[model samples]
Target: MIETYSIWNLHGEQVDHASSSNAPRVDNVKPIVDPNDQVMGIIQDVFPFASTNINQEGEDDVPTPIDSAEFEQYKKLLKNVNQELYPGCESFSVLTAIVELMHGKIKYRMSNLCFDYFLGVFKRMLPTDNCLPKDHKHAQKMLHGLGLGYEKIHACKNNCMLFYKEHETLDTCPICNESRFKMTSQNRTTKIPQKVMRYLPLKPRLQRLYMSTHTATDMR
Candidate 1:
């Protein structure tokens, strides 16, 4: 049989029309992979005339090494993070401290969930350190002018459905028959929601661009 190949995207969707005349562009296209899909090899076009490792005599093909002095700067940042560790510390603070402390000392294991979790802790920590007015307060103390609003919606504990529109007054999840909250000591269920989702408004987010001096210039 003749040799055959397939192209795919990050979502594991087959790319039927990914042909390109440029070899460099083809190399930049990453193959999409699905968890269950078997991968034979990466899908990219290679030009017969293209050269990769033909180092010219007078020209340097290797990249310059990182400066040894720059490592000290990173070391100092870690010391600062290590100084802020405390009991009952938020995950964000703990992770930030660990990352800063381990900078250059070890490989950083950064991920989306890790970063987002700590970011929330960092934001919460910032507001507690100052006594600025509620309207003037921001986690970074830099975006005091920025404003955002979110709506909290009641959601099922099992995540089977959302109590929206016709189900606003629902006290129990229809599918699971689970109470909206636990029947604790003082009926705390009524005081606090069990599962809540914040709906960030898009209109205000768009408007914030024009309001912020840092982004206003770019928006214009």
Candidate 2:
């Protein structure tokens, strides 16, 4: 891995800069389904946008970047796993609940019946007695397989513009009367961000080409 430093020639003063993807967790992205175009399609179907400042008229109506054909490719990829596997059920809620029980702190003691029920249902889902993939582990595997996801930048709450290189200094949203921060206390009183724009990163693509077993050393 490459390393970087910020302390300079004169006074050793340094400004810190860091970034990360702000997309929702895989579970929250759309429960039990693969984090592919299908999730976008389903979400957009359920909650169709009632006009948006972010796009030209009716542009937001078509949500996913891929057309119908590419989506069918993904749908076909799952047929071997379950011939009857419908579009809505890629993963299992049993796994989701089991994962939640494992990660979260419990108030009740050793013999929780609901927890036992979750484990029982989860065990039943396995084809054999030996093994099953954990939800979070599978999520990590999917994330790594995707190479990387998208990072986000703050946006105007009114959708006037994105607060990027040119508009990073604005305090309030210029288009609307809304303040950039929340109206409540705590971080809201400070200069906290309210909205964001998620976009895919290019650096991970370059890194993946270098790291990929199939592509490394074949620069062209």
lDDT of 2 by residue, 50-82 (tens): 113256664545543555643454443332223
Off by over 4 Å in 1: 1-145, 186-189, 216-220
Against the true structure, what is every candidate's RMSD? 20.9, 29.0
Q: Please provide TM-scores, in order, for all candidate models, with all chains considered together.
A: 0.33, 0.32
Query: Which candidate number maximizes TM-score?
Result: 1
Q: lDDT tens digits, residues 62-173, model 1?
A: 6434355433433333333333334444333322433332332235674545555655555477546422212212222321111245798888888988888898898898
Query: TM-score of predicted model 1?
Result: 0.33
Question: How far out, in Å, is residue 213 in model 2?
Answer: 3.2
Clashing pairs in 2: none
